[model samples]
Target chain A: MQPTSFENMFKDAFENFEAEVNPQIWVQVQQQIPTTAVTPQASVTFSGVKTLLIAGVTAIAAITAAVVYKSEPKLNTLVESKDNPVDNKVEKTVAPVQSIEKVLPELIKENETQKVQPAPAPASTTVLKLPETTNESSANNDNQASEPLNTVTNQTKIKESEPVVEVINQDDKHENNLSSIQNTEAEKTKETEEIKDFNWGRISNTFTPNADGKNDVFKIHLPDANYFKATILNINGKILHEWEGENGFWDGKDAGGYDLPKGMYVYYIIATDTNGNTHKTKGSISILK
Target chain B: MDEQQLVTNCLKGDKTAQKQFYEMFARKMMGVCLRYSNDLATAEDYLQESFIKVFGKLSQYQFKGSLEGWVKRIVVNVVLDELRKNRILFDSNAEVTDVLQTTDDVVSNMEAKQLLQIIQRLPTGYRTVFNLYAIEGYQHNEIANMLQISESTSKSQYQKAKIQIQKTLKAQTII
Candidate 1:
């Protein structure tokens, strides 16, 4: 007989071995096995995915709606009414007169102008012209009128002589009022323009006091010469040391006069300008000892 | 099924595949747990807990390295949790200078089991380092992370464990 093939013999022997050994171990494994079924968490995961999809769809729909809404034309009737010719003409004619009337007392209170030429022109013209109207008797009244006319001519000559003084005072007052308004508006614009330029750039907080000359001191070089206070904090958020003055220098020492260990620290700087406006910057520093 | 297919099926929540995976790795993981645990029952408990954790966190496994390594890490973490619960104290000295001198005669005479027994008799610190470095082929830096000790301390503890085991074996032979 031919010798049994190693593969067949091995397979038979392995099957017998498994048959003999598997039952006991399997039984023990079953007995120790937890009674609870390992419930599939797929439903929970699917619900989570469903919620996320719904949220994403809602967000996308909201954004699309907002975009479409903004792109659509929306005309305001109130704005259109203000631009209409009838309204514009009425406002243009009335606003200046009302504004002038409102500002007159304030201008007078400020003593910015002198009340001279034409101060009571309309009232005096009406008062003085009444007698000329009532003297309707013909040539018989003319001689009497001529005598009054000579007195009127004398009064006109007196008024003509005072007109130059009145005109000079009125011109000076008008120029002063114009300059005061222009100066106030110019000052306001300058303040707004200055505020736009007040941004401080990147600042370095890391400082090494190892005397190696790499990063020796924590320096906050302000963009401008301003009063500043800097405080150093440890990892526990305790204010370890603080320096308040013009100098932006902080030595790497705690409040208790001890060198802090090598680790991360925080530095906060509060800078105040001459106008009393304050800006704050905070950052972290890594110290290597 | 091939190992990858089995792993894929396990990830798909195929209970049969998961059971096969548990059977394949549980014994070896139990051995790992036994080394870290105080006794057999605690070792068994840690083994079961580690398997549950391993299954729960299976999604995080990126298949970058050996699956066995991932399972072993879970087992070790489970054992460490038990150790932590027992409030085992760890020395925090940064500078550890302890050195153990081991003779060639001690190594030639002592079996691995004898050495293991002596190590198990050691304090938690020395045994952890010895098992991680000597038996598990871990570098001191890796051992440092596992035990939260400085690298130098890990090296020193391993050397101290070797010396203590050698002395014990030497004493046994003389007796």
Candidate 2:
């Protein structure tokens, strides 16, 4: 039998062993950090017409709430942004939107801005006129943020359409201490403008394709997209499978239904939401079995 | 900053602190991953999965034991999970009482890379058992519990792994 020294020899040799980690692994790890940490996850219920309206409205409301919370002290932006006539329609449809505005006056002093523009008059006709004295003060206060807001506002209006336009219009004028508000609004509007902001939920990085009913398929979450085309490729860049529409998934099998050997595969997705905006994303998925 | 401070910052989702912590443990943990995986790619996958888990569960690390030990435990568990998921860990009731003929000098003489390659070359079941028992310093019962195999199966796998490693060492010496 081997002496006890044999075991010690192995342990001693490896106890402090260090191998060079591939720099790419860290890059992949960075991407897989839960999105919930940066973007607060808000699950809201809605009974609706088509999936388009539901997801669009949900994304606008949910991301609005998320962006509001993200900047914490910028609670005034939500109330001021929601003060418009169109947003009044959103508040009637979304309970969370209604609740979020109620807590604003108690949380911050910026509610004075909302008091200055409480006109329930249709904002659709009021377009482009800065809130009288607000534009200069806000522009002077946050030059950097307002610069981007100026550039993106037109594009956001064209792509996302309706609902968010008036918010941008008012926010552009009321930029005093509103850097985070403009930033969140710009960010949320940009996100929503992309593919109707179809909340793809979380895309799991790994799945077991052994058919045990738990994550047996590597599903790309496309909750409300009207059209989607994806190709699953091997590391060698050979296309293994291709499918269309939101029901598309890679079951760890080739087109012939043969179980692919367990390893990492790349997925490229191009999808069009109901608003006809196309989004393209590339990522890797691991087949556990 | 010190380890405790680093952990606190990482928990706060500080990107710089997270990168710092990853740099501190990644190499040693990569070494651990290499021992359990069959190739560099698989090992890299294991490393990525382990670090993601470590960061995700960093809140649960109660600061009781050595941080290295806690991190290594999570690394090993991640490897075991991948192995189990792949279904390569087979149960064997057959006993292997044959004495390991390889001497300690062989291990000492071999480069750590050579030893690691030899370990990686072993059958998945044998290599896994050897890793858990001889290298990771776990008892056969603990290995069995972790692998979902019986105690006897764990003992036999370890014994067979030792014999296989000894034979490989002997062959290399002769060559």
| Best candidate according to TM-score | 2
How much is A191 displaced in model 2, in angstroms?
29
lDDT of 2 by residue, A44-116 (tens): 2121212323355433443344434322222222223442442432222233334444644343234334334
Residue A171 lDDT in candidate 1: 41
Off by over 4 Å in 2: A1-3, A35-289
| DockQ versus reference, model 2 | 0.34
Full-model lDDT, candidate 1:
0.52
For every model in order, what is the number of clashing pairs? Answer: 0, 0
Tens-place lDDT per residue, model 1, B1-175, is 8767777777776768778987777666665665564334345556656776677677678877888878888777777775665455555454445434444455544444444455545666666766666656678898788777788777777666666665666677678
The CA-based lDDT of model 2 is what?
0.66
DockQ, candidate no. 1: 0.02
- Candidate 1 regions off by >4 Å? A1-42, A45-289, B92-113
What TM-score against the true chain A does chain A of each candidate get? 0.32, 0.33
